[model samples]
Target: MSWRRALKDTARSGIAVEKKRLEPLIAVRGAAGLAIVIALSLWLFGPAAAASSAFGAFQAAIATFQRSWRPRPELAIASGTSLAVSTFLGYLTISKEPLFLALLVVWAFAAGMSWAAGPTIGLIASSNVAIMLVTVTLPTSVAQAAGHAAMMIVGGLVQAALIVLFPVRRWGAHRDALADALAAEADYARRLRHDPVASFDPQPLMEARNAAAVTPRQARRRPAELHGARGIAERIRPVLASLADPAMGVPAEGPARDRVRELLASAAALLDAAAHAIRHGEPVSTPPAALATFRTPDTGSILTGAPYRAMTRLNTLLQDVVETAGGAPQESALQGGAPKGRGELRDQPQPTRTRPRTAPHHPPRRRPTFLALIPKALKAMRSELHRGSPITRHATRVSAVAATGYILGTWLPLGHGYWAPLTSVMVMRPDFSQTYSRAVARLAGTVIGVAVATGVVQAATPGTLQSGTLAVASAALMYLLMRTGQFATQACIAAYVVFLLGMGGEEWTQTVPERVLLTLMGGFLAMLAYAVYPAWETPRLRTRLADWLAAQGPYAAAVFGSYADPSASNAPDVRGALLTARTARAAWHAAVARATAEPVRHRGLSRTAADDAEDALAQLGRVAMLLEAHLPERGATPVPPAARFADALRESTHKGAKAIRERRVPTWDAVREALDAWETEDTDKVLRNTATLVLDTLTELSEALDTAVPPMTLDGTAPEKPDGPRNPKDSATR
Candidate 1:
């Protein structure tokens, strides 16, 4: 594709993308808040004072919309305070170039460190840097600086008040996340019913899980319901994969197939209903007929095989959904009458099941005060000091690049030198893909915005009032499009910058070209810095994958050990292990996504190998979840074979992780032997079946490791070595 076509395509995609529902409201508030501040300043202080005071309003508006979600009151207060301090410091150093330069450098370092806290705080800190730079440029007295700072604080306060008065539904994001997960599950089921071999993208579900994971503690009004919905969605994924297996003999046609399709449709509808209820704060209505379709599978039919197993899993999911809807599952809904020979599939343990019934009577958590948040902010900054952390590396890179841009801006003859460093700071993101993409978009948007602004200024020759109006509109547009992605945000930001600069009595024709060139220079510097000393995700993909693989062992051991020796004391440890493994898995997925976004040549693993590894990890997670779900509540099972299988699985996973780390082949002999021995040993049907599932998943995992592990050296820099013969069986059993 030509560059023009590609750019057009990108613009179309960005414009068409859907954003969070509350985003438009936040954008409007941001614009209105700043406009109010500017209007008040103009009325009280006149044109000259209003010109300087508008900078304060601009900073406040930027701070207001910097985060993906609305800030809690504590966070908003912290942000306003930071802006005030930075603005005061800027005014203090306005007369001393050396002091100003030193302060900027120091603040850049601090801003970089703030990234460890989270994206929201990182953006706030970065905005502070930008505000300080802009504020220092305007000539002002100490009194004027204080007044401006107060005005900015007022702007932020207005935003916070609006948030309190017309608060967003606390559960909106969570409800949407759960709804998306279930929708993905429903799609996968539909695909399985038609073409078993068809590929299903797991990205949507992963994104949903990540979103759900970040639910604020205060927003979790219906914790049990949220947990139940999420659990059901996760468990259904593996069951769908099992049904897709050819050996399962799921009928290609007949009553069994029709029944399966109906069950999937009902599940999807139920999920949609639950999502609507949660989003709107209404009650969920369950249809009795829909529940009945999945309650009993026809005996002596093709449903007797894998189809029946899938139905049982579906029935379990239905029960969870019903509970999440604040209704008890009828006995019929709970009991899926399978064929006589088939054993019951156990329901996974709900994470919130242990909560007391009268928990609502407990006092609510105290809101975070500003003093309390100070320690948290400091702790977050401190945690990023480690050399190996991704955020630390990113912060260091951003600081170096921004400092270089600043030095060049000072030394060069450009009229608007600050634009160079500002561009560098804005574009230098942590990951290679985002950094590169933002650089391109920033440059492109600057060019387009300059041209458009120049045409408007020359044609209309707008005075102060018109320029101010245009600036407000542009600011509102910037905030509205900000969360969509970099491209849309850059376009709007470029226009906002153009209108904002014009309001200060700068000629648009003279300033636009200089601004564009300086922005381009800054963007190029940022991209070049990353390219030269890149922290590309591809290089660390193996390490991240290995870490995830390693975590699985402890997670499995903790869960299966509980089955062998069920104890109330072990519950916390098991839960912690599960959480650890889940976190590691999320990290690995994020790594893979980042790697994919980078240039193809930088990717160490082939697409096929990466996909296989991801699928294997996902399957293993499901099996582990299944094992965790079925653990006996109180008494010890003392199943020797089950214990042996768990040990062997743990050992094999550990060995595989080691091999990947050391760039050597892994042996799975002990794992295969343990599986074979466990199969032969006398055991209960439930234990036997679960163990068989584990072994099967392990074999697939071993195969994926075989494909993925051989492609890179210890440092993940070199090509694959030519090892002797490639045999799947031998490699897996070694």
Candidate 2:
């Protein structure tokens, strides 16, 4: 897999995590303001020493910001609550009243001991420690410590309040993202139905499919949704309990994944049928024209007599799932009566029961042999392998590298360079491109922050009204600037960090430049390391796309063959072809993101090649649909030589597409072979399959035309509809 492309995509996702998801979560947690609170506290009561007090505040603020950027809702809220409660306890202790001293000690103990339980506990303990150290070590009086505590308490309270305000807003954002994912998936599914083999990039479709399946809705709630701040935390336990394999924390091996995949496939199929019906002005409530072929396999004896009728009934049973999820009561009812043998409960039978139990008095229950379901299973497997494959290794390698570097930095001798470990985590992401941008921002932010901290301390001094105003303003600004450009954030964070530091006096001249230089050096080194072993993404994407297409070719050929010589007793089975087509569709979607990430030049070629391949796959889907419908309407006689006709056209079209992608001009031999294949195979199957091939072949021709024409740029127009009758080209030697 293309590690670099994957990294870039993941990093971009991370930025979204930080911005739309993580930042709001932090606010709800209330610990996001911890940085400002710490900065203000140290500046107010800490030692008047210029660099130490200023630098300490800056350091503490940085730590707070980093730590506060939590993702999970429970963690964020827990951290915020812990920090707020801890701040209050510390204030009470700083009051130095005899009665409150015990309370303070108990609070401090709880803070430290419970830190492992949550961010809240850790923040509380840390804040108390900060207050204790600053109050005792600094030359400040007891009153000053109390004053510091008061400011922290206010900051923490404000943070807790924001949590209530932002819940719905965050949920809305999540919902929108989910919606976009669904639409994208639907679009890809439609395209897949039209032409599965044409595009080998399936990442977008897979991501979209998963995202749609798991989208937050009032009607359908997954276990993980309970972890959200908006939902009841207790609900998480039940949701988790619902999951199978108690030890592994995933659904136990059963129909859970299968059910979900089936639902998605059914939904996609139904949507496709619905779209076609509506487009052609067919009645929406009527049986889908596309589904008739799913009832029987072209190769099987199962389609004769009563079994054939039974198969048609099963097709009707499966249709509701595609029409609407809510309208699947019929499907549910059908499955409800499905026989479960010994060791199984009677009601709500599991989907995987291999054979029906004997009623003893009646004929053996034969479960419907639905061939369409094969496509769904193959599609799911293909999807799982693609989306989960490349990134698994990539994430593992990154985690290993980061962990090793962190261990080395911590255990090895590195004086005043403790920041290296932190930088390593921040900079060395799988997505190296964004790492450089983040590093640049970090350096810039650190410098500006240090400078501002010095100014605040030297000028207004902490605990004063003017200093408090600056602190609040800085906090708000920091919030606003979080995910904007790195340099803009550099200035924002720099100002905030500096204000927190005690360099407010005329001493800023000495320390400001030094901090900036050190930060720049850290960022520079991080980027350099990324470049040394940089990964490019296009290679992996190409390999995956190629693999998917290669697998699809034989399947497409088989489907075409099935279309041909319909009366041939030993025709290839429709089930296998459908399964292969579905798998190819899933694989195609999984490669989309990786393909899109490639440069325009590469993406164009890949997409064009994929589209050409899809034309053949789509024709196969159509043939399968036709065969399924035709079997019940007529007895199991040969459907005619449609398969060979389609195959002949696709073979030439595939060659043409390859030629176009390779930038090779087509010779007359290729042109002649492309035309002659269709003429030689004359039947309805031949006509439809040949027509599909010709459409794709023309698409490849257009792609090739770009190379022939000057002033080149990628043109990704929808494949043009073929016009006029099929004009047979002269037969050329292979």
Candidate 3:
């Protein structure tokens, strides 16, 4: 990618408007909170103070709308408190230019480092620096500063109180996440009837896991419908794949395969219905025909060996889903005929049979609460303190840009010196793509906003009440269109800032040119900073791949190690490895997305080769998931050679990751020999069939990652090959 192309792409992306769902109720609530704070401050302190206090409510609302799993009230309170602290400290140094400039850089740097915690924290923290600039000028004495800061906290408290008093879809995010995971499984089931060797994305499951974490206070108040449903969904995905795949369970074409297809269809319907129930908090309305298929013994008679076991397990897991949805205890949702002699269920026909009666025993997964995350956040930020880390590089870049913007704004004859630093702080992101893209967006929006606000101010010459009303309206519009891409939101925010400044008695002539010109200079400074010193994702591609490989190996070994000694299988270890692998996979995908938009070239890996390697790794994870679905019951006889095969795989992959970092082609010779040993020694058909597929997938992974490429591919598209994820999928068919 060239600089010209990059600039054009960034501009196109920055101006693009996205479709977003509007929440009229939440918007109204936030606006109401802002209105109350603005009204009180105007009556007691004056319009200038009112304009400053409005940010507390304004920022609180935006924080609540962030894509975080934490409760809205918590987000509101934290945002308000942080803003108050920034305001209080800024007031202390407002009279001294040198001290205030030092404070601004340090605050901007800390905000930049907060990205390591998550985007939500980083965004709120960054906005605080901008807000601090506005509030610092409002207070004259130290006592007045304290009172002004307290009003900010009060604004936050007002919003939080409103939320607690009138809750709307309290568990909405968690509910949607769990429902999406179940729905994804249902969609996967439908797809498998036609393509049994299909690949299922694990993103939904990972999101559900993230949503499941709660503090102790939250756990006690959590809805009954949310508990334990995610675990059942996790178990269902592997079972669906194991039953449908021909190599693992049934024949490619036969009466058994036909029965498998019907079972898959029924499972899809039932799962969809369960997802609806969970999402809406209602009773599960299952189809009688689908229930009848599971009840009829004919399907079981057709399915034998591994297929029969899959059928039995799927039936039990479905029953668990029914009992958990809407917190129903096996009412007609999924309860019916007697369960087969699956010895695990104490009673053949019991109305109260819930997850504990049949669901597999997996270790409990706990997500850390907002309070518990403090230490982890500290640790994460500490790790990024090294100069090479992107977060550190970004913090440094933004800090320099902020100080430079302040000096330029002060020296230039623009009376509102803070607008320049404010624009720079708002536009600068950690990566090249986002930083450049947002700079374009903020700059464009500022020009349009200043023009509109100037025309309105000149025509109306509005008083405090009128200006405050327009500011409130702009805020409501901003909240409503928050998801319509940053460009749309930036326009509303810009107008809102201008209206607030009008309430503070600023004329249109003085504010318009200054707002537009300062904004332009600030955005330019941020863009220039990123161009000079960038932390390009292209250089880190190999490191991300190595991390994924290192995590992927242990996950496969944990699942395979279970078959070697069923009684020794530790559910917690397997779950931990799965979570680690998912995180690593997500990191690589994010890195790829960032690297693609960059102008830098990949050191050794080409675009096409990188895609191939990513596909191969996804295939390997899919195979492991299938094996996990059919893990043997505890106390079952051990397959000793399976252990050796697992050990060989773990050791070989560890070496492969090390080779990848060294830019060398990896070898899977040990894994091949272990598979050969397993084929000769183990008569277990399940082990025999899957062992070949695993080895083939591993070999495909190594081949895809190699840097050396043929001059032309099958389709003659540069050095890119026509072969994709299907190579391993095709091998599984054998």
Candidate 4:
């Protein structure tokens, strides 16, 4: 390649890598806070005092940014309180060796259990352990320790102040999430218009939904608007999927085809408009007259076919979309107006309903006081803890390793033995994959950081000002690359540690080898702890997959049941079932990804089987979406076979779930009988064709599930084939 072309390619790759890093603004805020705190300490105190205070500020700053997504006040309070308690404990035990070792064990266990609450809280707990380890080793008086703790709190407060002064824009993350969902829906519609049988991936939409779910509700401009938009997006997916199926109805031509295309284009445009409004924090207007020409096509004419019928259904959904976008209650839109009987179809079409001319006044909501918030927060934390949870197991492992590491550190001929336990706490995670990966990264990063620190220290010893500057720079670089992956984060953290220690008047050359060796010992202990009693995703794969399969039964039943009784309200129930199934499926996919990253020997499901199962589930979701789309429109004659097919599907799915749970082979006799009955029944041609597709997809899903696991008895013991258990290599190939 030409030099210019190669250079351009290299630059593009670098930009991509940087983009994977955590938000740069967060890093800048952390660095700025640390800089201010360090500068103040240096100005007010001598070099030695400044170094001590800087240590406290650095720890507090790290804790503040550790969980940046939380509300500003909460972040500040949590970080400050956690650091103070940890620092005080460290100081208290400085003169008591046995107590210090005992507390280290207890603290490690507590930090690990904190993971049950969530990743953010767990990070805070782990960081506190690190702070305590570092602080206890420092030679300082009681008053000095107290003062240092206060400085750390000040550093956290500075970060909180910056958050309030320069807040993220209203509806920033929420708007983006909502817009992503809408855009994905619009793209799906566009694809269906061109390729009726095209396969579309639902992962993007699923991810967008997850993103929206996590967004802080208080940050949104209109919380209700987001809810309404998400509802519309979910309803639109199945409709587009059904329309894309060639078996749905007769193909339209000439003016009929053009009209159908026009409707699809209109649906896409409406979604685009809704997304645009969300992005700009404005109101969404109703679609123009061209998009509202659903009733223009005569239902009694020869041109009335599957395309026309599909377009008619599309019109109803679009009306709901427009009404929802205009701030009409989602309940009213979702119910699709009053149900229309066949007799009502003969009359002239009424104008579509829009939002009311005047809004109803409502009293303002009362915000909760701090006193009330305390109980709620406690209740939430309590709910997160349970027996046999990942958190509990992790806590047990972490505490054991920490206690062992501490004892070993004391006995080993190494200075600053606290580094052993500190490294163990840093490397351990709730999951095996994360813990192993972190251990590796921590070891490698420490080696590189030590080498670099040695060179810098030999070249020139930094003064108080120089150390402070280096600390700020390293802190920024560490956080900036933290989110990229474990390796980048560990590397930055290692470098940050070097500068941070220098500020404490430590000679880098002496500290470097000791730090590296102690880190290695801790990392090894963490890995061993996990290996002895792993919380591996592979072992949980079966349960997760079974949950997803089981959820599909209720979801399919709800969708099909809606068609049997159009006048009855089941929309909410159906939506709930669909959401549950989606969540389970997402969880299963995540588990598979984690399993892939783990060792081959530890994996339960082979890569090939996992991939096949994932594909089958995706196809199953699409089929379910198609069935939902083909639900009888208001006033349309109910197809008797539709209910029968739905019942069979529900039964088959339940049976499949039972098989998975019981660890036995799934029997397809009932499903096959349903298919036979479906073929014999006197059903509408369209409904029969759709039923065929559903049965075929279910059969495929069952076969995929069966292949995904080994043949096992009712007691869940795998029985080897006559040739004995298949080789691991063969399982992967199969």
Candidate 5:
């Protein structure tokens, strides 16, 4: 070969060799994973003679996986791999002696159990091992030990397969849950559109909404608030770096970042409010009045409040997610044909109603009695209880059912079967709906671990002392695995150890098929139990949205009212409002979770409504900030004509009433035209125009609801601007 060609060929060969070298490391980890499967199976299902040994290896693998997966600086996958290999090697070394093999299995079982249980398991496993060590069982001939080990190896391999194949069906269901909950929240928010200032109590309904939205997400992904914290460092670094720019000179960038940070900090405070609303069963305060000043702080100081603190953390988290997702692309126009200009509001399409204009002015006259309102309120409260929270009475009931199943499997006559024990644990876990995959993992891991254990036992010595020491080491390994958080690894290690010790001359292969059958049976039983109680997820989402929407009006009004007068400390009242917004948002999240739990149902209900509600609340918040900034200059603008104000207020009240009933908004165009004109009027004319527009709109909306008209699209006309006076609707003069 030419020299140049030789060097290139040699380099290629070197790369290939390195690649080949890494293959064994990967294989070793997989093998170790198998070892864990074997371990757990052996302990849970092994014949009395071999059970302890299998338990030891199983325990060791669990501890190793736990240590590996803990929230730390280590790469979880790598740590788990390393520990698995260490365990397999440990088994190999102990395989050579009869005493060692026996002790190894016992220790392995204990360790595996410990790892599965965590630190608490370690203490229990250790104590158990100590007792077992102090009390040795029948002495085994080398041939007898070999036979036992071989059988155990088989069992381990079978279980290993099952462990590796566990599937995640909950993820998709969770997504659906979110979508539905969002729809419900949107429905609730729609009711608040007319009530600009009436405070809507979040109460029980808000909590339901948050539960519906957030629960499914929680089940699907780690909370951004929790896992998102790490990315904060990477996020702030670039911002800080920009501030350090020589051309920029002074660190002016800090102010902008701080403001963003402050906004997030305020989020935490809002969360607190959400929690309070849930606890108190009332509408939360509005966000606008709550967060106006922080939008433009006098001193760039970190403000403290649960909402603010939460926001700060979330901001850091979101920034990290945004960065990882390749940082926010240059702010493109908002999605879905939103107007490019900043001031345009998309006019929702008006409903074409044939209802007569001469319809009586009073709302189909609600019988004005507290007794009449009581039934409506009670109904709303019930809806809130069911649909608003993610962790509902239904979830609790499910958990109880699972616990009962465990007890039944444990206490029943069939409890002695390997299947019964395994089923008790596997079936109760919320994630067990995907049985097909978990069954596969259990089988695969079992086979691999059993095969390795059989081979190790065929070449060893025979002494109790060595066996006891191996047992202790296995216990320690199990402790570590339990800490690492990988059940498969823990199970595999355990099975291998039990099988190896059982390797003696007694024929044991015959039981292999039986063990597999039992395991499958246990898993199937659990899945069946989970589906039987079937909780309805929709109510929770709807309830939460209703509760939060109820609070929006009053919150907006208070903040606007407070901002109108500077001598008054808007801070305390605004803080209270911020707390309420937080509560409402949380409820909205819960509702999303409840709605989307079922994909088919969720897709039927778009998230746009909920999004609109959130947007409206946010907009109100912006208005509060604007009013706070400009209120002193404006002075409480003159109250508009009482008729107009009364009309709007009445309309808002009707919307609130409709929302409490969980009714969808009806379509209306004449009212829409009148409202459009009112929206553009100056502050001095707002009350009158809004009132007039609201009165007409409310009458129309109530009529539309009676007919059950579904709103589909926006009116498509340009939204009226708030800066200038606009012509009043010709119909309004009537």
Candidate 6:
């Protein structure tokens, strides 16, 4: 990308506001917590103490707004505690500029390194750095600062208590995640009606899976309707894909294909209805025509053979989804006693739709409890401490910028030296686009926010009470507009900070010019820091791609191994491998997105190769998913030949990954040879067919990942001739 294009893109991203629904009630809950803390502080302490204390509630509220899976109260408490510690430590060094500056650098580095843990931690940590600036400069004794820090902890507890007592749309995030997954499937099914090979993004399903992994406390209170639905949705995806693909089940154009299209449309409507019902906790109200379309779908002659069976299986699963959405009848009603309104299935008279659903693919995987995950998070941070890691690079860059911005802010005669480093700390991120874009957004927002508040304060010269009131209003707006855009939220934040300073006895007229100028200097410093010491993703595309390829091998092998020995089936093991592969694939996708925005050369993978490799790998994963949907029963006869193929696949892909990293054309000789050997022996037809599909997809993956500079070997020797393709689409009917 050119510098002009990069700048334009970042500007547009910085300016864009999401068209999402305004979550006013949720914001009000957070603001109400802020309001309580402010009133209490003003009454008990003074305007200056109130200024220092309000940030605790303010930050605690912001933590609740993060899209985290942890409990809200936990998030609030953790954020507040982190801020209190930073505030106390920051105050101890305020009398000495050199000491505070060194501490700022170390703090900024830790904040940047926290990204390896997760975005939530990283965001809160970064805010702590920026908040540390203002808190340290409040001209208070160490004892007084400790009191203020204690007050911050109280703010957190108060916020947590409010959250526990006045819950708004409880389990609402989980509901939306599940609903979004269902809605995505609905859209995919509809698209398949016209384009059978149409692509689907699995992010929503991944998020749903994440949301479903609840703590022990959460599991007990979980809504009954949400229990089994996500598993059903996961299973539905591959079945939908396998049923629609022309090569797998349906004909290109015929009466049967038209029947398939009808089934697709019906499935879409049913899914959409289920999604809506689940999202709003309402009874399922599917269209009558959609229900009728499932009538005799398989029994009719319109679909036959595999397509027919797939259609039948789909109708059965659709019933399960609808039933789950509409919910079961009350226990009392089921026993022919008194009726209850909740948990009643609507439109439940279809006696023919009674086909049994398979048990959920596997029990939901257990996510670690919040307390238990800390050690793991710390381990991850430790891993990222090396020089090669982007997190480390980002940490180094941000820390340097913070120290430099602070010195320059103070030396340049700005009375509020903290504003510069604070701006730099808040705007800088781990990647190029975010760091640049947020710099632009934050500066613009601060200008507008500070100017508006400055005008009001200068005009009216509001006293302590009025200034506190105005600050609270700004904080409320900050909460309300946080998600709409960075620009809007930062605007409110700037105005809020202005009112806070006014409450703290700072003169409005003297601060306006310093605020805007220092903010600009800070933003410029952040952007410059990134440009000088960049960590571009373009160079690591090959490494990311290889990592994904390596992960995919084990996932496919696990599925194949299960078929080879049904009695020793490792469903959980396969699930774990599948999750690892998904993480690797998601990492590759994210790397590519970030790399594309960078003004750096593509180091290892060209654009065309990356796209092709991505598609081929997605197809491979989809094939594996389809096979997983129909694993053999525990006592079923095993396909012995599959075990050999699985071993060969596992070996070939691992070597191929090395070849990929060495910039050589990856060869799949082992895979091809194994396929030839398998063809010599007769096997169970379905197992043979699925195995061939897997092998063929891997071959496509090999061809899609080509490099032109030179051919090299994993051991630094010359390469051998690439293996010829033996398409499995031929062994079976195409």
The candidate that achieves the highest lDDT relative to the unseen native structure: 3
Candidate 5's TM-score reads: 0.36
Cα lDDT tens digits, model 4, 295-401, are 44342342344444455456565555555455343333333332332443435243333322232122212334334544654555566567656777788888888
lDDT by residue (1-734, candidate 3, tens digit) is 88899899998898889876678888888888999989998999887778778989899889999999888898898898899999999999979999999999999999999999899999999999988877898777988888878888988888898889878788888999999999999999999999998888889999999888876667677777787788888888988999999878688899989989999999999889889998998988887788777877666457766666677778878888877785354455445542454334333232223453234243334657667878988888898999899999999988999999999989998788888899889888999999888988898877777777778888898999999999999899888888887787888888898898889787777778888889889999999988898999998888898889888988888888888888975667788889899999999999999998998877767888788888878877888887888777777778888899889989988988886776666667888888778877746877766767777776677677655334433345443222223377786776
Which residue runs does candidate 3 get wrong by more than 4 Å?
327-372, 708-726
lDDT of 6: 0.81
In model 4, where do residues sit more than 4 Å from their true spots?
1-18, 21-23, 41-73, 168-170, 190-227, 250-389, 601-605, 630-652, 668-689, 706-734
Candidate 2 local lDDT, 1-734, one digit each (tens): 25565446534543332333335443323324444444554455542332222323322333334423122243333333443344444444544544343543344333333333333333434344333422223224545434443443444443444444544233333333323333334454344333332222333323322222322232143222211211111111111111111111212233433322332344345444433432233333323333323421341232222222323333333343222222222333333221222221223212222111111111221221223323543444345333334322333333333333334433544322223323433443334455555665566557556765766566755543344345445655555555545555556655653443332332344436645554555455556555554444544443443344344444444545554554544233544544455565665554554445533245334555555444434433433342332232212334344454445544654564353444443222433444455556544532344344444444443443443422432353333323322211110000
> Which runs in model 5 stand beyond 4 Å of their true positions?
1-515, 550-558, 564-573, 576-580, 583-587, 590-661, 666-734
Question: Model 1, 245-363: lDDT tens per residue?
Answer: 34345455666657666766666666666656545556667666666665554533546544455555556665655556555434355445343334442332222331122343223
Per-residue C-alpha lDDT of model 6 across residues 303-368, encoded as one tens digit per residue = 544455466567667777777776343211112211111222222221133212233334555667
In the order shown, the candidates' Cα RMSDs to the true structure are 5.6, 17.7, 4.2, 7.8, 21.2, 5.5
lDDT minimum window of 10 residues, candidate 4: 724-733
User: Following a full C-alpha superposition, what root-mean-square deviation does model 1 have from the true structure?
Assistant: 5.6
* Model 6 TM-score (2 dp): 0.92
Local accuracy of candidate 5 as per-residue lDDT tens digits, 1-734: 23344334323332221111122222334335444544443354343333433433333333323211121111222223322332343334433445433443444333323322333333333323322321123124444334334433443343334333532222222222322322332232233222212233333333222232332214244322222212232222222222221111222234533443344344333333333332333333424422442334332233222212222333333223222222223112111111111112123221121111122111221222323433653454345344333223333333343334334434555422333334333323222222223333444444544444334444543233333334334434433333232234334443434443443222224334444455555445544544454344443444454455455444444544453454555545654665575577665765565344332233223455445444444443333322222222233333333323324333464365444345454222333444565566655442333334333433432333333323432344332212221211222333
**Cα TM-score per model:** 0.81, 0.41, 0.93, 0.78, 0.36, 0.92
User: For model 2, how big is the CA root-mean-square deviation?
Assistant: 17.7
Clashes of each: 0, 56, 0, 0, 200, 0
Those runs of model 2 whose alpha carbons end farther than 4 Å from true positions after fitting are 1-166, 181-208, 212-416, 445-458, 463-483, 489-514, 550-687, 690-734
- The number of the candidate with the highest TM-score is 3
What lDDT does model 2 reach? 0.38
